[model samples]
Target: MADLSTLARPYARAAFDYANENGAVDEWENFLFIAGAIVNDKAFRTWLENPAVTAEHKSAALVDLYDSQVAGDNDSAFKQLLGENKGSRYGNSISYPKVSPALNNFIKQLAEQERLALLPEVYEHYRHHKAVSLKQLDAYVTSAYPLTDDQRQMIQTRLAASLNASVVIHESVDPSLLAGATIKVGDKIIDDSMRGKLQQLKTQLTA
Candidate 1:
């Protein structure tokens, strides 16, 4: 099978384009995040996989789930859009009108293709697109202990300067590192951990 990211590229690109054209990238980002969470849930996954459940039921369940979550927000645009498209159909494809047109169309297409499970991958790709367009980077920082506000700010400042883009740091604690930290940006990893140093030393001695 193709990689999930590979499969998601076109859909993500389409969504990004639509959102960008309408200056709704952030809105789409939030929508996709919520939608992705819904489809990725264990209970929802099981329900989707059950052969006894029809596609219509799955789509309706998804629509209901999305509606309930977004309805309480002060922004009624999404709710109105969703309501307009309620029970709307495109030759067996479920439609979610009143919500953003682009998103509604995207959801309908996913339903038609039975590819709803790809939502998370699609959201990830969409986020990458959004970040690139905004000249931003997401940095993953792993350390022996939780990072302090100063440490996070310092790393963010340095990374922003180095990358020439705004940087968002996500921190994680991995005690197995023994000490020190590792920073990951895209495909690059910079490791300064004691464990990493020891491994390098062992390699040098063996060599």
Candidate 2:
């Protein structure tokens, strides 16, 4: 894990910088989204795992798959970069985006050395990077009590105002919450529930 973090840091930072410079954060996000999906696919994952297939073939396959997805300059650059990377390190868990030849070389060194799978952690860290740049917060709301659309909107609006960022929300019913609602915005929490209230009281009494 330490090794994976070490490998992922520079790559993630480079991608973040590129996205910021080019104002292509959304584009990069989409590309990463698609590429990650492809890499995670059973067939594609198998192909990447197979040592027999040359790196060129894998790179070609990806380029063909994403032929019209990105602009011409980006398409060529990324394809060549990833192709070389896949070839150099035939198999090992990795998650760094192939930003360019230089970065790809760095990742190849990491992969060939068999550091560890860094993709999941990289994605998590990158999400935070993106969120900060985009000024967006993702919230997961679980409620024991049902919420009306108006109520949800009010809460979201308040949260957005307080955080000074846009909000993306997902809602679910959690009977175990016992009452009120629990909202998680990034690493922050706003828990307003009977269970939470009880815990507060218990803590105060013990203290």
**Highest-TM-score candidate:** 1
Q: Compared with the true structure, what per-residue lDDT tens digits does model 1 show for residues 26-92?
A: 6677677767877888988877788787766766666666665463443444444434433222222
Roughly what TM-score does model 2 have, to 2 decimal places? 0.66
- What are the per-model C-alpha RMSD values against the true structure? 8.7, 9.7
13: Cα error in model 2, Å: 1.9
Off by over 4 Å in 2: 1-6, 68-123, 202-207
Best by lDDT: 1
Worst 10 residues of 2 by lDDT: 89-98
Deviating ranges (above 4 Å) for candidate 1: 49-57, 73-98
TM-score per candidate, chains pooled: 0.78, 0.66
lDDT of 2 by residue, 121-161 (tens): 45455666888878988888889977899978988999899
- Lowest lDDT sum, 10 consecutive residues, model 1, at 87-96
Error of 1 at 173 (Å): 1.3
